[model samples]
Target: MKFQQPLRNWGGSLVILCLLLYLTLGANSLEPLLGPLAPENAPAIYARNSFIDLVGWHLLLVLIAISAAAVIAILAALFVSRPVGADFLPLARSLANLGQTLPPVAVLALAVPAVGFGSWPTLIALFLYGLLPIFENTLAGLGSVPTTVKDAARGLGMSPLQRFWQVELPLALPLIITGIRLSVIISIGTATIGSTVAAKGLGEVIIAGILTDNLAFVLHGGLIVALMAMLLDGLFVKLERRFATV
Candidate 1:
């Protein structure tokens, strides 16, 4: 396990280093191939910001949105998985389903009028779009805990709260983390669209490219986002394995 940990860390680190090298040194070389660069035809490479700024802010927004969504999902799952709150599961599921079914663009469109554009609207959209998977996975994980194990905890004089905190949560953690991973990766891709609402993100680059027919901008943005998603997914896989082996 110790050996495996270093291997995983190295793998993730290598991917990140490669991505950074590309963003810093390789992106410029690909510009000619990605699109025409005439002054009249091309969009300014990044429009308003540097590549590092774009990637940094995009990731920051995504991190904030996904963290919020994960917290909400976990709390909701904890509440609804309990016997006292079991009856509300159907309602909770319905709401989470609704969040998924409504297109994120539509959510953004609706949110902008109320939230007045920018990161807030984007955050709202991502949070809503990310809820279902995490909620469902948390519910499944918590519900999957063996009854006998629970009974054993009771036999040992553990309180309900103690059992849940010490035993059930640890067992359920891997699945819950998986849910978070899914939600985060989904959010990473979806968040690129946030640029349309005047929120700062890689999506701005892609959208600018589309409007101006500059494929270089689009490719750069997509590459950054794809690398980010892969990096995060890899990290989460490591985290899930760590929790599972515990």
Candidate 2:
């Protein structure tokens, strides 16, 4: 597990660092790329007062959405990657194709009727949209497990479970992480759409901006979402590198 140590260390450290950065920005509105934080409407309300709520709640929505997607992804990976005859692969591919082809907004629209607005529908739409990346990568990683390794495990009288756990899964971890990275980034961006349903997310800022023609609010919201996505992606990359076999 020595090879995994660096990944664990860096993954934890990077998240901590990003958290610190987020806290700093929350406290001070540090990033100038988003322009001024705008003056609050009251005497006691500081210029950046809303920034704290915006950043905090936006992050909360992202985590909630990502968690929903993760559950979908993990279940899909478990079910889809199993040794179903080669026949099942094409079905997975076709389904993934369809999933990706449907616009997320359309999915949200369709879901809104059934699920009836709010974060639940938004969460479901994002999870469905994310399914392709996770499913495809799981299939690819499982398929690409080396024949020699499989043979060696079998030759040693290892059970299928043992071989998969000890060899195939470990090797496939990087690809799985890649899929998760894609999913997380997409989730973060898509989360903003939740605001359409009156679900709080960074999208509120964008929606507010549009309603009032406030460019600064839009930029502020959009920039934070982008930063959060980039930060998470960097952490994933570090995890991938750390776990990558030397």
Candidate 3:
């Protein structure tokens, strides 16, 4: 059974890795066949960067944006979940929901006035849009920890801080990770719109395709982003399963 489980995990990992590789290389390999489809007078299919450059930099920006959102959301969730901040939970929830309530494009448009375009405004928009899920899940996970478990920890002479670190946080981790995973996937899709704000991401290709009426560019960009989201979500699923076993 143990051997079978490890083998299954290895197989899954290998499959995902191959899929990622195909997503990364397949479009470029097929470009020759697909390139001819573009209108004879169409502008260049995509911006000046090579495929690797486009995907690599776009991914980096996405990671940066999501990482920032995770940090901010987790910290804020932790704060509001505490007893001292309990009264402010409703307000926090509202603020978190506000991100999703506004369209990413509108967020970008509103932000550009202050941040003035490029990746910064896009980052801000993604960060805001990602907050609600993480915040809600964090709250749910932390709140779901049993009262009896907390009481037992207290009876065992564990300090509140110790109990939180060793017990509550560990128990809540899987759900928190789930929230992070969802936020990341959603961010990956939405980040494409960043191109409209002058940020470099896969969305640039999609937008360019729209401008030139080139479907190839749109397909390539969309495929890359979709594959990236699937890969990350798969990793997070493994992580969640591991946490579940614990």
Clashing pairs in 2: none
Model 1: lDDT equals: 0.81
- Cα deviation at 147, candidate 3, in Å, is 0.3
- How well does each candidate superpose onto the true structure, as a TM-score? 0.86, 0.77, 0.87
* Per-residue lDDT of candidate 1, residues 140-166 (tens digit): 888889999999999999999999999
The Cα error of candidate 3 at residue 199, in Å, is: 0.5
Cα lDDT, model 2, residue 171:
85
Q: Give the alpha-carbon lDDT of every model.
A: 0.81, 0.69, 0.77
Tens digits of lDDT, candidate 2, 175-202: 8778878877777767687778876677
RMSD of 2: 5.3
Candidate 3, pairs of clashing residues: none
- Residue-pair clashes per candidate, as listed? 0, 0, 0
Pairing residues by index, what is the TM-score of model 1?
A: 0.86
In terms of lDDT, model 2 sits at 0.69
